[model samples]
Target chain A: DVKVTQSSRYLVKRTGEKVFLECVQDMDHENMFWYRQDPGLGLRLIYFSYDVKMKEKGDIPEGYSVSREKKERFSLILESASTNQTSMYLCASSGIRDGGYTFGSGTRLTVV
Target chain B: AQTVTQSQPEMSVQEAETVTLSCTYDTSENNYYLFWYKQPPSRQMILVIRQEAYKQQNATENRFSVNFQKAAKSFSLKISDSQLGDTAMYFCAFMKLISGYALNFGKGTSLLVTP
Candidate 1:
């Protein structure tokens, strides 16, 4: 089955630490996205890539960066993790032809 | 920018009953798409149903259906004969080509199914 796979399901990070969250899609989709999900805030887009090495900032792009080195892998990076960044992170991919997105199971990160 | 609203933060319904989840969005675009996504305790988000603004007919998937009113910008989901497995956090999202297909989601409604 076509899949968007996140590297971690749950993560605990210390404040001020640099964190990396990885996502890989086997579907060869052209668009990849990272979103931060929180209670009452829904899902806020952090970054999205439409092509390899091409990234665009979403509404809540602050404190986050993304890298797309290959067609199937997109990585989200936290330059300096902070307590406020604690939330569930989701990764998704989609093809241009079909706007439907395939989401990964999500990564719940707890920053302390 | 589009904004989605889910006023009902929590809802409960007994098994075999019918329940509706309301979603409203604000957008000036004439052509777009609205979607309902379900996220159970497992945290795997699944697309429950979707409706294209241009289509006057509502979209349905088995026991799930949508009431899409383009004039009011309302997209409500109705679940018939609710089951225990239907309990989950339901999110309403809006998408448009102008926004690069990035979904604008509302604060989800937490639904519980009881016996």
Candidate 2:
């Protein structure tokens, strides 16, 4: 099975903290995505990267950034964690020609 | 931008019965894809089924099938012989032929299976 591993299953941070959420996929997928899931908001794309050193902003990119220094790893950064940023963050990856996405277990972040 | 809507926030079905979850989407693109994903209590998102817009026939997998009404912009999931393992949050999603194939997901319907 292709595994998408997240660094953490749960996280807590104080306001003004710089947060890092890491995701790694062993499937050698070319496309990786970060999504924020909340009640009533299903899942909103935060950012995505199609290749190394390549990234694109999704619908809600404010207060968030990403890095894809390596093909297997994609990282989501919170410049300054805020209470409103508290949500379940999901990491997903797919092959260039594949239609289905393989998702990580997800990390629930709580910002105080 | 495309939008997926799942009006049923919650649904329940008895074991061995059938249940349907509704979903609708809005988009101008003629060719696209729709999918159903299930997230169980374990929090892992699993692909349940997928349907291509150009295909007239609905997609099915084992006891899971879809009612794809392209004209109505509706893609619903019908689960037959409901099992407790089926209890989970089901999301309807839409994707265009874009480079990333990023999905536009609905709010999701929480389906609970009863004994």
Candidate 3:
């Protein structure tokens, strides 16, 4: 079975503070993604990495950036955390084929 | 750009009953994939079922099955003999086969399976 693990399950940060959410996958998949889920809005992509050091902006990448220094790890960074950034963040990894995506448990971020 | 829509925001069913969740998507691409994902209160997203556009046969996994209509761009999930463990937020997602783009998701439907 594939396993995608997130660094934190819950986090709290003050306004203007920088936040980091980490994700690691054991499957060595080539594709990794970050998304924020909100009520009635579903899951919106924030950033994605297809390979090491290669990143692309998703639909809602503002105020957020991502890092993929290694194949197994992907990190999402918030330049300046705001209350509006508070939401459940999810990380997913998939293979080159149209295989199913494996997702982390998600981190519920609270920006006060 | 592709978009997914789940018109039903909430639904309920008694245990051991059957329930269907509707999903529709708009996409110009002919080759794509549709999926149903379940996120329980624990916040873990679990892939329930998937359908390939080229295939006419619906996909089934145990008690979970999909009603895929490629021409209509519709993918509905049906859960038979629903259990309390089936209660969760269900999301429908779409992905283009050629573009390698991210999965487009719907707003999701909150399901309650009462015992």
Best by DockQ: 2
DockQ class, candidate 2: high
Task: Report the candidate with higher DockQ, 1 versus 2.
Answer: 2
Off by over 4 Å in 3: B99-101
Residues B1-115 of candidate 3 have per-residue lDDT tens digits of 5889999999999999999999999988888888999999988899999888889999999999999988888899999999999999999999876433578899999999998
Look at candidate 2 and give me any clashing residue pairs.
none
Give the per-residue lDDT of model 2 (tens digit) for A1-112.
7799999999999999999999999999999999999998899999999889999999999999999999999999999999999999999999975789999999999998
lDDT of 2: 0.96
| Native contacts, share recovered per candidate | 0.53, 0.71, 0.63
Return the lDDT, model 2, position B17: 100
Off by over 4 Å in 1: none
How would the candidate models be sorted by TM-score, starting from the highest? 2, 1, 3
Interface RMSD of each: 1.5, 0.8, 1.5
For each candidate, what TM-score against the reference? 0.98, 0.98, 0.97
Give the per-residue lDDT digits (tens) of candidate 3, residues A20-96. Answer: 89999999788999999999999999998888999988999999999999999999999999999999999999988
What's the lDDT for residue B60 in model 1? Answer: 99
- Candidate 2 lDDT, B80-112, residue by residue in tens: 999999999999999888888888899999999
